[model samples]
Target: MQIHAHYNGAKPDPYLINHHLEDNRLSPESALKIIATSEPGGEAVGLPEFVFLNPQADPAPDKPLQYMIKELFVKETFRSAGTGRALMNWVIAHAQAAGCARMDWHVKPTNEAGIRFCRSFGADAVAGRVSFRLMLR
Candidate 1:
């Protein structure tokens, strides 16, 4: 919720968030969600969500499956404590183990800290692309 507020300027409804998580849990092959804690059964201090795109669904038959990181959030208190880096490294390792072709994600243009962290991982921004959204609600 804090991450959503930070990126979207609003705190999303708890019910909606729960519904989304439940749906993801029901479809494990399509998405992966991780919660990080400081110790055994501790409170969650970080989360990372990933979506898998099956190569068979794409028109390009030769393409391999890809992983898309939908969100990576570490509580403000945990920022710069290596939590984010650890989560990213774990995700990358998981992807590699699954033989994923690549991993991709988007960062808000004004999120300088997020941008720096991503760049530190050797992520490059693609040019000539514009993000658009259509709200149905």
Candidate 2:
């Protein structure tokens, strides 16, 4: 919820969150949710969510899977404390172990900090492409 609020600048609907969680539970391997904490059983300071994608035609023939990061959030207090980097490193390693050909994600054009963080990992944005969405509800 905190991560969602941070990005959206508003609280998310609890009903929607619960519904999303239940759906993920039904197909756990489709998504991965990771929380970072200072100690075992401690409060969360960061969260990263990624999904495994299997397309009809694999983008990389040698690797059958791909990873798409849905969200990556580190609390403001923990932003410069290596929390985000740690989360990203873990995700990258996990994707590699799962035979993912590539990993990609998006950052809002105005999110300079997010852009810098992604660039630090050598991530580049796809050129000549635009994102579009349709809200069914």
Candidate 3:
């Protein structure tokens, strides 16, 4: 199966993520919003089938209204096999193509999969990673 930019990605199958995340009400919706927008405003890489990446350019360039990301999730679907890796590889290649200095994200302290996933893309922590986010909405 070819990877298409699917919004809402196959309804958060029980096998994919922990059950609690799906029922968290806002998290799934937020995930939906990210998928729907295609260019999830805050994603380090704006939503698009493909986006231009530059390591030299600061990904989180402050825009008055435009959202940016520090800890972006490089999503992939397991069923499609290597699709997730494909997406991430593309992103990494894009970054190199655009001459990005580097890419990084902080995985959860306890998220072994997340850590593993990021490492698969050859990601490393340049500074303090594995922190917390206190979203007050």
Q: In model 3, what is the error at residue 129, expressed in angstroms?
A: 4.0
**Worst window of 10 by summed lDDT in candidate 1:** 55-64
For candidate 2, write residues 1-137 as lDDT tens digits. 77768867998999988787777743556456554556366877887777789866557778989898888888888888899899999999989999999888889999898899999999998898788999999
TM-score of each: 0.78, 0.81, 0.41
Considering TM-score, where higher is better, how would the candidates rank from best to worst? 2, 1, 3
Rate residue 111 of model 3 by lDDT.
69
lDDT of 3 by residue, 1-137 (tens): 11123433455544444455356523634422222123346423222232223333444443212121233333442323454455566656655565555544445657686667777766665564345569999
lDDT of model 3 at position 44:
34
Model 2 TM-score (2 dp): 0.81
Steric clashes per prediction: 0, 0, 9
Off by over 4 Å in 2: 12-41
Every candidate's lDDT: 0.79, 0.82, 0.44
Clashing pairs in 2: none
In the order shown, the candidates' Cα RMSDs to the true structure are 3.2, 2.7, 11.0
- Best TM-score among the predictions, by candidate number: 2
User: Distance from true position, residue 79, model 3, in Å?
Assistant: 5.5
Q: Which segments of candidate 1 are over 4 A away from where they belong? A: 9-16, 23-32, 38-41, 55-63
Model 1 TM-score is: 0.78
